[model samples]
Target: MSTALVLIMTPGLAFFYGGMVNKKNVISTMLQSIVCMVIITVLWGIFGFSLAFGESFHGFIGNPATYFMMKGMLGNATWKAAPTIPLLLFAMYQLKFAIITPALITGAFAERIRFNSYIIFLVLFSIFIFSPLAHCTWHPDGILAKLGVLDFAGGTVVHMSAGWAALASALYLKRRNEANHSPARITYVMIGTGLLWFGWFGFNAGSAFGANALAVTALATSTTASAAGGITWIFFDMLRGRKPSAMGTCIGAVVGLVAITPAAGFVTVPHSLAIGIISAVVSNLVVEWRTRTTIDDTLDVFPCHGVGGMVGMLLTGVFANQHVNAGNTTGNGLFFGETHLFLVQLLAMVGVSVFAFFGSLLLLKITDMISPLRVSAEDEELGLDISQHGEKL
Candidate 1:
């Protein structure tokens, strides 16, 4: 059951992200999420697992000494936290995460990239960038984790890093396609929003590693925050004498979910609500502000996910109560008057963002040296759903 739940979570993200894109590109976008999951799973077993979970090296990346399948891993317990479950199970859970990290970047380059090239980029980026990152932030002896960066889940590892990388890819894809500039399809966006909310229960609460108090509390807080965020966006829309559109409500829900991810294990229901509302307003403002600039963040992944992740991480520091999570080393969080924790959270966020952005950029440039990253302008105009995959919308 533990093994099944972890692997399934990434595909759940597929429904969430696929539905948000234009109807024409639904399969194309979802394909990125799905394919990433599978490819990462294979890579994880072969080399990624060793590179990340093997012996610690200089507090940066792990060693590749544990190479090959079923060798060092057979029947032996080579893990921490949960030993009763097979080491393979724990490795798969982490593998699902590695797969999705770069898959999430696909959203940024949605309509323009060559499918074959993206497949290549996915494999390389997961190996070069994500494996090291997961090692740095997740392993028991990881530098950031050792320094007390409280991810709880993957606010930094998944959202912020993907967001930064997504932005870079979006820019690198070179603003192709007239179709993307068209008004987004709200109906499709709403469907994506619903799936994201449903899957997040597993995404956040499941991080507890069991069905227990902290898990239950996280589920409730995640649920409440999402609801309040949707309602808050509605309220904000009403204040302007306009009815809230489906897109607005969904973005609100997404922001809330993103904000709650980091703080889920630490804060109470009320804090989740506050963080949700604040996140909706802040992300809304960010989207509006970003549009005025030259950065063509195709799906606004950075503002909603990246910005929301940052908000949630900082809010975790602010609202975190060690009473809730015994693992939280900082006994008193920001709300309890320990302000330095917030700074630490920001520092951690910045570190991950910088690493993911540059690391992914280097990977893409290497891929580009071998093959063009984006589809031709003519193919993009014709639409990725049909051009890259050879399928109709």
Candidate 2:
């Protein structure tokens, strides 16, 4: 049940990203998101989940002890106040994280990559980069989790990792044809936004496991900030004399959603507002600034997910209120003036960004040995869907 929800959940991300690309690329766009579901799901079953959550090694990577489901999982609430779902169920849930992390990378290189190279890259990225980061950050006794960093769902594990990986992939892949001024599919994008907004409640609140008060709090805060983010973006667009485009509203809503994820369970409804506002500005600036550079992040993943993740992680430090979680014994926030936690949060963000950036670039360089990273220029001009898949939408 959980795994299915997890799988269904990421397709919404497809809509969110697809809508931002040109209609000519919309089908191809959705295909990338769907393809991630297929490739990552099989790999997760093969060994991705195992290497990530199976067993720890030196506070970094997992032992791959559970490879090919060779060993069974612990089956119960084996860790702290974590969920008590069956181990396989837990594995499946984590698989969603693995799949979606790669899916998020598409936002950076969408409408450009050779489907073959993209697939190979996803396979390599998960086994090498994503699995280890997840193991180190999310596993019980994991170094980052133990280091007092705040990430309720995946500010670091999913967003930062995907964002940085997207960065490396964007650089490694080089440019696509007419990559500039590639228009987005506003209708599909809006649909994706609504889907993301719906599914995100499951994403954030469900991280709580029992559907308790924290889940409620997370859901409420998630919605409040997304709404605020949409309005915030609209406020800016209107000021600039452009119509408050649907695309802008959805993007803003997404920024708000990303901003609130880490702090949802940690802070109150009011703190949610501050997080949404601050993150909206940062993400907006990043998307605008990064696009002007030579880097062709086909879809701007680094700015939205990467930058938004940092904002959320940092805000969690200032706004987190432990009174909300009497049971959350391992972590505490800087709210009520516990300023020390803020430094810890900053360190965690810096560490994640640096590690993801370097690690991703290394993976790209090594993978280049087996296959080229970018699509042929001819293929890019024709569109990835037709050139790669022999079908154009």
Candidate 3:
């Protein structure tokens, strides 16, 4: 059930990214979002899942020999990380996460990347970037897990990696030639946001690994955070003298979802509200700040996902309560008279940011050598829809 809901988020993302680009590149933008679903699915089935979830290797990555080609995932055995469910089900659930991670970076280079080159990057990122992070954070005996770092879902593994990669991609790819333009379709964005909002219940709640109190709490927190984020962004926009915008609301809501993901099961409902509002405000400031710069992070992925994920991780360290979930291996936060978790989260954030940013930069350069990463100047001006995919609507 949860796997199905999470899968819908990719198409939701497609529409969300598609609507934000200009008409000339709309189809190519959506296709980038959708294609990862196809490519990553195959990669995950082969060895990606093992690299992420198989037995540990020096506390850094999983041992591929354990489940290469998913050799031992069949039948009714439960996974070690999530006991009580079929092992295969757990693998399927994580696959949804793998698909979306690369898809999210598409927004940063939406209009100027070569389609074939993007396909290569998608595979490379899943193996080198996403898999190692997932192993360190989510694997039972991994490094961050041993350090008591808490990421209920994937603030580090998914959002932070994608956010840093988005920044790297924007910097490496450089600015788009076309000037900033209006969204091609506000209606498409609205529809996409609605789909994303609906699917997020599964994204957060399902992380609980069962239909239980924690899942219910996560569901409640997800709803509260998104609502708070959306409203807070509107107020911030008003303060800046810009009219309230449909696109702004949609982006804000998604930001809230990203912010709450790491902290949902650990923090209480009230703190979730704070997480949403503060993250929205901070991301809004960053987006505004970005306008005066030359870095073309086309859709503000770093601001909304990277910075928002950081805010959530910080707040999780601040607001987490041992009483909320007794299963917490890490103890309470500073508010509860402990300072260890907060410091650990900071270190983890810095480490992951360095890894993802430099790792993605290296991947971009490597992939460029294999195949030029960007479209030709003439093809870019002609638009990716006509130049790369040879299709238009």
State which candidate has the highest lDDT: 3
RMSD of 3: 0.8
- List candidate 1 stretches off by more than 4 Å: 1-9, 74-78, 179-188, 240-242
lDDT of 2 by residue, 275-338 (tens): 8888888888888788778888877888888888899989888888878766444445666667
Per-residue C-alpha lDDT of model 1 across residues 84-152, encoded as one tens digit per residue = 456776677667667767877776777778888998898888777777777777777788877788887
Model 1 earns a TM-score of 0.92
Each model's lDDT = 0.77, 0.79, 0.91
Q: Provide the TM-score for each candidate, comma-separated.
A: 0.92, 0.94, 0.99
In model 1, the Cα lDDT at residue 194 comes to 69
- Give me the displacement of residue 35 in model 2, in angstroms: 1.6
Candidates sorted by lDDT, descending order?
Answer: 3, 2, 1
Q: In terms of TM-score, which candidate is strongest?
A: 3
Instruction: Note the clash tally of each candidate.
Output: 0, 2, 0
Clashing pairs in 1: none
- Give the TM-score (vs. native) of candidate 3: 0.99
For 1-393, candidate 3 gives per-residue lDDT tens digits of: 888999999999999989998998999999998998889988888889999988899889988778888888777778887995898899999999999999988889889999999999999999999999999999988898888889998899999999999999999999998957888999999999998888888788999999999999989999999999999999999998999999999999999999999998998999899999999999999998888899899888999889988988888899888887777868888778899999989889999999999999999999999999999999989989999988988
